[model samples]
Target: MKWYKKWLLIIVAIFVMIPLFIGIIQHNKKLPSHISFEGPTYKTDELEFLYDLTYQKNEERVLEQQLLGTALEIINEAENFLVVDMFLYNDDYDRDKGEYPNSAQKITNALVEKRKDNPTMSITVLTDAVNTLYGSTNNPYFETLEDNNINVLITNVKPLRDSNPIYSSIWRPYLQWWQPSQEGFLPNAFNPDGRKGSIGSYLDLINFKANHRKIILNESRAMLTSANLTHDGSSYHSNIGFVVQGDILKDIYLSEQAVANMTGYTLPDVTFKSSNETNGELEIQLVTEGKIKKALLGALAEADEQSTIKIGVFYISDRQIVKGIKEAAKRGANVQMILDPNKDAFGIEKNGIPNRQVAAELVPNKNIEVRFYDTNGEQFHSKFVIVTDEDETTLIGGSANFTRRNLADYNLESNLVINMPKTHVLTKEINDYFDRMWNNDDGQFTVEFEKYEDQTLWKKAFYRLQEFTGLSTF
Candidate 1:
């Protein structure tokens, strides 16, 4: 070979090998101590389940939203301090599609009003960087909060492990050095009419890691939910939330503190008073990151022939979870799943990649039943599983979805596990909620599995590849 050709070959190999080495090192490096946290199980009687529903009743779109109403109430009642760590907090949606409730603006107004009413109170809002398109633009809601003397902290997701390492490894070593600027000429990835994003921001977005926790807490109570403050062009998406008071508030506070600490911010010193009341029949535990997966698998493992497992989630592409559900069904446990059809993004249509393919895999079993949430331009975004045994029931729900990115420590996630006797009021309420949707008691909430079942061989292969490689968004 010619000398110049040999030198060029060497340069190509060096460039290729560098990113490969970085990817492996970053993937296996020791994570922050607080990443996959499992808080102590606390027994308390101050748990309330809140949900939002958007269903079709007699061809009319009916909306019954209780989650955000309670969240606003919590903000209003907090006198001393308020901490909100939401994954999405923006109103950058396609207005041509539909009219959303302006949830992001509502949340901002509530916080600003509270701050004005209690001038001395400490208010901090922590949110993912996606609201600003990874710092390529300024979010008006955050700006309003900051201007009102409230602290707005954009979570630094760089410290979190990269979910899409195939792209991030190269970006981290080659492109991450350039900080994304607020001014840009490129069109916005989320909304074309919105502010443009810089090339650096787009590069950073390809890393595909986020602090995907949705939590709101004060000095006294905490709430964890699957709802984002932002509507994302779909205001009527279904979601679930839990509000609790007791020592569990401290656990939620500490978990948020970890994120603040990782991002080099110090949360104000506040104490959560323990309830002196008697322990209720329910037991609650807080789990974050990978620990959510551990708790979920543990609950599934306890199922028996006499048990019933019901899952309603936005996404379900995690292999272990899929396998666990199959195993439980094989053990004679009745398993039913309600999943989104994966057919709607902001306003754009989506190929039913993961959920439809996943449902196709599970429905082949005689014991496993699956249904698609009947969506009309909105998604069914609830992420919860209920396992009912003969004497007790276990419920797991919160921000984490049953997907590799959300549950495998790649994205920061939080969830709560509740255990109670079968006769408990909360247990009955949850069971009734599931039955209402599953059976379409009062509305057309769900449809037969055949409505969106796809057995396409290539799509199944694509789903597996995307789930494993983190190449596509869940």
Candidate 2:
């Protein structure tokens, strides 16, 4: 063989082999094993479980409830330290929608004001690089936070497992080195503006993993939410949030620190001890990815003929959870699920891939019933599962989508488990919310399965492929 020809072959092999190795490393990244589903429970009157809904009547949009107000109120009252990890934090919407109230900007302003009031206060914000399209575009919200001295850490998700191997294999070796240069040729997929992004950004988007948690921690309290402080999400979705004050808050703070450590950020010196105060007999547990999945499975398995399970989710494509629900139903457990139609995303139409197919999977069981949330061009973005029996009730919820990527430790997530008697106020609140949606009380929050039932073979197969491969946008 000619020497130059052999050299060219060797160079090609290097490029191929390097990316392959990187993909392997990312797929097998180590996960923290110490994180568990056991946490302290506070019995204070400070626990706030809130939900928000956007509805249109007489052609006027009305926010039925403002759940995020609690989070903003927490920021306003903070005096010592504040730590936040919001997944989405931008105002980029479809150009046709014009402009909306920038939730990220609101959060930025709140942090800036708090810092100005107490110059010595510590503030840290952790978010995903997708907000910047993997460095292709700049995030003005994060830039503002940094300028105001609020420490901002974009989560380094590259160290985590690759959800989409086909994309990451090429992205790992070649595209990552070339920064995205928004040549203004192609339209921005996220917003309505005519801004463009490079092919590198598209490759980054296809990697299919994220830091999907939303949390806020301060000296006064801590909160975990399923809502993004982004304007698009704020205006057109139904979301849920929970706030707690006690030793559980300390556990939550530690969980936030663990996520920061993954991105090589040195967390501030903050120690929140468990408060020895009790208002009732409620216990809270902080559960992340694997732990969250395990806790959910355990709760589902606990249900029997006399028990019932009510699940409300934005996405529902996890096989194990699906299997658990089916098996529980087989055992005569009453299983009811309210799921988003998965047909709308800020005016963009989706194919209803996972949810519709998943509903089809469950509808055959007599004991299991499913319904579609009547989103009216919005998304039903709540994620909560409640298992109830005559004696006690178990509530598990947070920012997790019931998808493989969100449950298999491929993406960072946070969920809370509250184990209490069936009569507890929090338990009653959760049950009532599920009941109202299930019964279509007050407003038409849900519709019968016949309204959007889909059992096509191709969609089912496609959903399974994406769910198993972590290739879908759950």
Candidate 3:
């Protein structure tokens, strides 16, 4: 080959290896220490944290009695307007058909019912087009609203229509790339479900994430929830939801509205109906960290002043988070962790980070308290943080995680810092559950949920080689 071609191949090889090298190096770095959050604080109390824990527990938190659904109810009853952005939305009863019952249907039904009762009320449902479970009934939940003239906007929507991932990613990519002028590619890429895409628009479905999940319901209520509006997420599987009551709710809702407009979808020119901007003595701020590592790390650094730190998350691998907790513990903060040890939560033992060796090293810290729970049958997926101030005010939950992606802006995540006058009973309940599991010798000791009892000889051999190779990044 010519020198230029040889150099070109070398460049590509280096580029490919660079990402792998970075990933491995970061993975091998020592975890950070615990620290308290003493930075600027949000003293708003109206916002509270709610999680729908996996069914693994006999009882942790349920949808019927939880604050998340009630908050949605309040938004539906809004006299001003209701706005919701979610990946999953239900127009039918999913759980009755052997699906798990969650928040989507009950909330959607409530909105539909509310719209009927109050014809003049304005409501908008904005969803990621990819998540619409359009079926034989035609997304009745959305249709019912649309037929009634309720505005609905579907997002990250390509023109293509197909239920198969292979069809969308593989076959579609090849055909569209090779036949740029093909009629099907453009139509299929932009006109998913035949409801979107201009007649002549041309584009393929790329962008793996176009707005994973977001919901801003009305001016009075807003949520940065991890649960999609699906049966498994809401009723069947474990999930987490956070509701905002003060000005932040309105601020977030409007911001999401702006995102909707910028992305080429239209919605009513909506603004916040009046809400109390002055939320009592608690300091509050809306923290949205998505891949801007430095910005999110700063937020975590500020949160290191609390004496008691309770962190709930779906994925926690942020070096800064580990550092924050460890430092806070060093600073005399009582750092206690309640984590889901089951690999399904973040994948498992050998295949994932909750590796026995890693967890063993992490738990040995004297100042930090770490407790892992079995989430085998259920999914223990909740991401929120509760910190207590000197005066004992409670900081509510949010979307930011102790992960590189959440804080470093690699991925967009939102977290709300609310100062409640007192820690709500619900927060105490969650903390208590953590305590119960942490204190007990075993929730069900027989089963070490986080550990892997089965591993092939090849996998073990590979890991041994990894250990010996000093390939700490692996």
Error of 1 at 380 (Å): 0.4
lDDT (CA) for every model shown? 0.89, 0.81, 0.50
For model 3, the stretches where C-alpha displacement exceeds 4 angstroms are 1-45, 48-68, 90-98, 118-120, 129-148, 157-210, 214-216, 230-234, 266-279, 291-306, 330-332, 345-361, 389-396, 420-430, 440-474
Candidate closer to the true structure by lDDT (higher is better), 2 or 3 = 2
Give per-model TM-scores.
0.97, 0.92, 0.64
lDDT of 1 by residue, 3-58 (tens): 99999999999999999999987776777867889999888778999998989999
Q: Which portions of model 1 miss their true places by more than 4 Å? A: 1-9, 232-234
In candidate 3, how many Å is residue 412 off?
4.0
Reference-based lDDT, residue 37, model 2: 32
Task: Summarize candidate 2's per-residue lDDT along 1-474 as a digit string, tens digits.
Answer: 999999999999998888888877777777653333345555555577889876554556667656567778889988778998888877776757444566777788899899899887889998987788666678887888888888989887776677777668778877777666756455677875736777767767788888888898887687798888655444568988888887677777777777777788878887564465766577777888778899899999988899999999999999999999998888889999999999988768899989999999899987999999887767899899999987999889998989888888778889988888888888888888889888867666788998999979999999999987767888
Please state the error at residue 437 of candidate 3 in Å.
Answer: 4.8
lDDT for model 1 comes to 0.89
Clashes in predicted model 3: 53
